[model samples]
Target: MMARDPIRLWLNAHLGLVYVFLYVPILVLIALSFNKSGLPTAWTGFSTEWYGKLVANPKILSAAGNSLIVAVASTIISTVIGTLLAMGLEEGRSNPWLDALVAAPMIIPDIVLAIALLSFYTLLNMSLGLHSIVLSHAVFNIAFVCMVVRTRLKNFDRSIVEASIDLGASELTTFRRVTLPVIAPGVVAAALLSFTLSIDEFIIAYFTAGAGQGSTTFPMQIYAMIRFGVTPEINAIATIVIGFSFFLVLLSQRLNREAAP
Candidate 1:
């Protein structure tokens, strides 16, 4: 066999190190979550006790419910608005300024966006609760949904829409029947992504949520718990969240790829 290139060997080693750096901590955390003794330093044996405890915890359950409420509401609102915005943007001539404006939320620091939303709510004197959080999340997620849908739209044929209209279908009917069917995969992908983002978001929810347990989301609960120390309970909760978010992101990625021309 020919000798392996030194550069290729070095590059492969570098890639392996990068993967280890990124995933080894996550692997450790997952393992410790199943530790029967619930000690990071020592693993007594494998057990599902930590996850069972999470189910019995009322606070965690309530926060999880609130997160679900916010995620579902925000995803629906954002998907509708963002999909429409994507259609408008994609169908129109591209403008650098307009594109920048649409992408601002995605590019801006999360802390900055959270602060801005809090300030805007204060300015409007809006009541802070799950509703406010839903709106704020929708605002943040809309741009992301639009971006994804626009990618799908990039390969779409507008002639089909025109043909449908010419065939005596009203614009609303055409959109509902013709255009909507073609882009359903992308819409679903965007909605899944929006839901995932809303579920894991913390800074914005913290800033916008009311000062009560009623509005507390899962991420906020996690933050509250982690302030004291890292517990097996926290690890279990994090593992569940991570698994859910990963599933959604992967599903979205798959749908997006399939929607491509």
Candidate 2:
């Protein structure tokens, strides 16, 4: 083999360090999930007891169901609206101000957005619950989805759209048959991203979920558990969540790669 260049060797070394920094903690946490001792510091052999306990816990089940509701609702709504918005904006005039406005939610602080949503809902006299959480999640989720779809749209061939229109296709038919097919991968990726964010979000969900056990989400439950102190059960829950998020992100990347021209 050719001798590695010093610069290339250095870059590889740096990349290795970065990966270790990012993933070592996550690996430790996953490993600890199998620990029978329930303590973070000591590894007292492997066990699946915590996973069983998680199933038996009614509160965790309820919270997980609530999170699923919010994530799915937000993902569906955000994917539709964001995909349409991205296509419209891309096909229309390219205005920086308008683009910034669409992206504001992604740039804004989560706490600020949560407070604003809470105040807006309170002003409208809307009841805060799972539905409220879904709406709140959709707000940011829409922006995230729009951003991803817009990136994919940047690489789209406008000629295809023109060809469809030239073929006497209606705007709806063109979008349904031509535009959507080209962008479907991006749309799916964005939807997965939205779902992941909705499930993992804590501060915004906490603010909008209102005051009921019925509205408690998985992240909210995790927060409460952490306040009590870490345990093997918490590790199991965290490992599951992290694994799920990682899987969705990886899938999104794969879809995006496949969509690339």
Give me the candidate number with maximum lDDT.
Answer: 1
For model 2, the stretches where C-alpha displacement exceeds 4 angstroms are 1-4
Q: Rate the local accuracy (lDDT) of all candidates.
A: 0.94, 0.92
- The TM-score of candidate 2 is 0.94
RMSD of each: 1.6, 2.0
Give the CA lDDT, 0 to 100, for residue 261 in model 2: 78
Error of 1 at 94 (Å): 0.8
Error of 1 at 95 (Å): 0.3
Q: Where is model 1 poorest over a 10-residue stretch in terms of lDDT?
A: 1-10
lDDT of 1 by residue, 42-154 (tens): 88898999999999999999999999999999999999999999999987999989999999999999999999999999999999999999999999999999999999998
Model 2, range 1-261, lDDT digits (tens) per residue? 346687788899999999999999999999999998968659989899999999999999999999999999999999999998998898898999999999999999999999999999999999999999998999889999998999899999989889999999998899899988989998998998899999899999999998978999999999989998989899999999999999988998898788777
Any runs in candidate 1 off by more than 4 Å, and if so which?
1-4
Best TM-score among the predictions, by candidate number: 1
